[model samples]
Target: MTELAIGHVTTDCAHAADLAGFYAALLDRSVDPGATEFFATVGRESGAHPVLMFIQVPDRTAGKNSIHLDLHAPDVAAEVARAIGLGAKHVADFAEYGAVWTTLADPEGNLFDIGTGQA
Candidate 1:
């Protein structure tokens, strides 16, 4: 048996609610408001155990993120475009193991990768 399981992934951003809303719309999930206006959660209503949480921070620096999310989609191109429409910026496209993936950054400049569901 696995000794540990993920609880949740927390993202620090300038605007917690806005970041949470962006992910909620992208994932087709909903945001659960936190105790204060500075925090919020995405994917709570999806019945998923590990959700995404957004926390408000004062400063947002510009640099490559040490950690990022990797998402899988049935239609890679369409999903990447949809995320772009939701304010994500396209970084690049890459291929590995005969599969294609796209890199993108959220409004706050957090990086994440999206891949076609292929082996």
Candidate 2:
């Protein structure tokens, strides 16, 4: 038998370094020093899996991705505001099933969600 685990969540963008930097600032994680303009990663300090990797794709698809990230914050409003300040665009907000979530697009237009409740 073999065991597997998720390692990285990679995104394709026009500028890898820029996208990686934006996420690094948003997550308070540092971009790996060995990063290059074509490829970059913002890694976790305590573990190896779940590193956020960005790769340059000059003609990458523009719009919401099929798989989007979901984030949780103590205060959804404030976090969404902060994400906007970091270059994210607020797309919309939804409330259902006793949970409310805000949709936002990253600089390159990759949509993600943020909510107060567990997703």
Best by TM-score: 2
Question: CA shift at 101, candidate 1, in angstroms?
Answer: 0.4
In model 2, which runs have C-alpha deviations exceeding 4 angstroms?
A: 44-48
lDDT of 2: 0.87
Each model's TM-score, in the order given? 0.87, 0.89
Give the alpha carbon lDDT tens digit for every residue of 39-92 in model 2. 998885535469999998768775558998888988999999999999999999
Give the per-residue lDDT digits (tens) of candidate 1, residues 1-119: 87898878988898888888888888887887562348888767666768898888787666898889989998989999999999999999999888889999999899998997576
Candidate 2 positional error at 90, Å: 0.6
**Cα-lDDT of candidate 1:** 0.86
lDDT of 2 at 64: 51
